[model samples]
Target chain A: MLDRMKQMQAALDRLPHLRRMGALFSETVLIKVDGQEFYLVFEKGRIAQLLEGPSKKTPYRFSFVTDEDAFEEFWTATPKPGFHDIFAMVKIGRAEIMGDILLLVKNLRFLKEVLALPRARREVVE
Target chain B: MTIEQITGRYLTVEVAGRAQRIYFEEAGQGRPVLCLHTAGSDTRQWRHILNDPAITAENRIIAFDMPWHGKSLPPEGFMQEEYLLSTKAYMETVLAVIGGLELNRPVLAGVSMGGRIALQLAVHHPESFAGFLAIEASDFQPAWYDIDWFHRPDAHGGEMGAALVSTNISPYAPDTERANTLWMFMQSGPGVFRGDLSFYTQDDSLVGQLHRIDTAKTPVHFIVGAYDFTCTPEDARRTAEQVEGATLSVMDEVGHFPMSEYPEAFRPFFVDGLARMPSAGAGAS
Candidate 1:
């Protein structure tokens, strides 16, 4: 999952203008998975800083769990899930979303497209 | 039902007096991402992207069958309407499905015909979508009507005036896979073809509407296939240029179906675009 996150971050870094024009341009994005979470700050589209400590001051935050089995089902299926089901969980309190709602919505399409990338898959152990 | 169960089940919703069942697979948990399919195809086109690691790692995703395609059955009287009405009906059905599922302001990602639907929704129902991802879409070029071939009689003529609506799915599939692929289209029958052609011909001077979209509240990103013959990359670029704050990315060596043809390249472009969106609580001005 961390590797996938890095790969995604790296992909974003490649787009210079996207970083410059981002809504939280210089702020750190605090991401939580399972019980662990970390903050990674991006400036000018590149990772400018990283913070591992628990800090509640970050301006942006998002969190989600990666269930390997569920992830596999999504990938292998022919007609996969749409935006409705994904967010329905959050709306119903089955899923948790932290931080700014408007910013999340603003970048909603961007987040969907990012998740659509193949490299976003979780690592499977044999 | 659990998130997994809700997403896993092949759910049905009534739209335009017809019950359409849509199949879906979901991951993560956050704002919904509605995936719309292209002409002659169903939700299956988004399979690769839906399961992409980048997507699952961050947000939840859903891809569904359009009316009369995939596991869903065509509505009664499906063939009675023009393409524009058909599209409008399908869009309404999609909205109903979303509402039935109980989601709010989903992000829309559509390809080809689906992309066109996304643009229309953005213009007509701006509040329903958080943003949109359009691949190989167009606002309908003015010269589209100038071509004399479209007005001629026969299937090819229908191709020009209306979008390419053919029950002959054989032409679209690899020769080895033609027989199996054609079955879906064959079942859809002539009504699907007629409705699709009508959608292709509807007046789509969306440029004026594009100017009216609230870009500050709803951002759009367009991904164009460099060699896409259906909706020229230039048209996608032009649309992007017109929408304030909209972003455009031209995928080289690719055609209209980037998600299917090159998932690796396509995934990153889309993922990066998402990461660029303003995080929630950024507030709308």
Candidate 2:
């Protein structure tokens, strides 16, 4: 899973428009998958970090927590009902979201594109 | 019921002497409900509604893709460069579909631009529909954003344009639903989004025309997403007040694309809207 996270970083770096999209969003996002934490730090439209464990001092601008199954489903090419979306997971009590909403809305496409990198790669391999 | 339970079919209809094939989907059996999708989107928006056994059990729901949209392609040489949706053109194609399919006075339901057209149809051709369910639509407003920004070379096939559109879907909606909405925005052809806005922001004015609607013949009901800024709940309220026998409903936590975003979450409001509308008997009379 860590390797896949690294791959997502590589994909984000290769994306031509990531910087333009990320220019509007520069913050550390904490992704907690069933208690295993990962921090994705973005700066100047690039993913500066995909580090393990939460950043001790810096407050996460956006955070999401979900079970491993939901996390895996979200990264799949085609996810099942409960795992397809963060919003859907939240509605069914399988996930939780915390952060600054304005930031999320403004950079949704950029973020979605970044998160979907692994799934896109998988679809290509298949 | 899941999406697999539904069935799809295509009907080639002629409008203004031009033959064009239109794609549509159907589910269950009972009263007919004709669903029209928002601009730049296809009938996929109603996948949940068509899949729901409860709604399907008593309603023969149908949704179609308009010309130059989804599986429905435009007539040759027409709309090759840019597609502009006008009241006359839209109505002609809709009437052609109704005639081609032989739909029996089906209940007209639509969202965004489609919702505006629903009201226009109700006012201009009252006898054509039994009832109308207009979602996130009313009157008219000046363009808030530059249409050119959507077509720029750097916008990446309207992906940048989709950024603005993405905000219209409530942030409270599940991430998957929001993702699907963005996917649809990205799939739209060049200038299609801008063309649709021409009707939404420019044309399609119903201010003084709301009085022309005949509630006795065709009742109109509105459902606006509380989070929708483009067509706020107040817009629907004002329009409903002008037309006799029209009812207004504000769906909590929803945005512009209610049917597509979290369909299960949106179903209750839809069911409530259906309940508010007068029943359409056996078939189109």
Which candidate has the top score in lDDT?
2
Task: Tell me each candidate's TM-score.
Answer: 0.55, 0.72
How high a TM-score does candidate 2 get? 0.72
Deviation (Å) of B156 in candidate 2: 1.8
Task: Tell me the docking grade of candidate 1.
Answer: incorrect
Steric overlap count per candidate: 32, 5
Give candidate 1's error at residue B203 in angstroms.
Answer: 3.5
Worst 10 residues of 1 chain B by lDDT: B164-173
- For candidate 2, write residues B116-199 as lDDT tens digits: 889889988878788899999887755655565566454454675577666467645777787887778778777777778777
Please state the error at residue B15 of candidate 2 in Å.
Answer: 2.3
* Residue-level error in angstroms, candidate 2, position A25: 11
iRMS per model in Å: 15.8, 8.5
DockQ of each: 0.01, 0.09
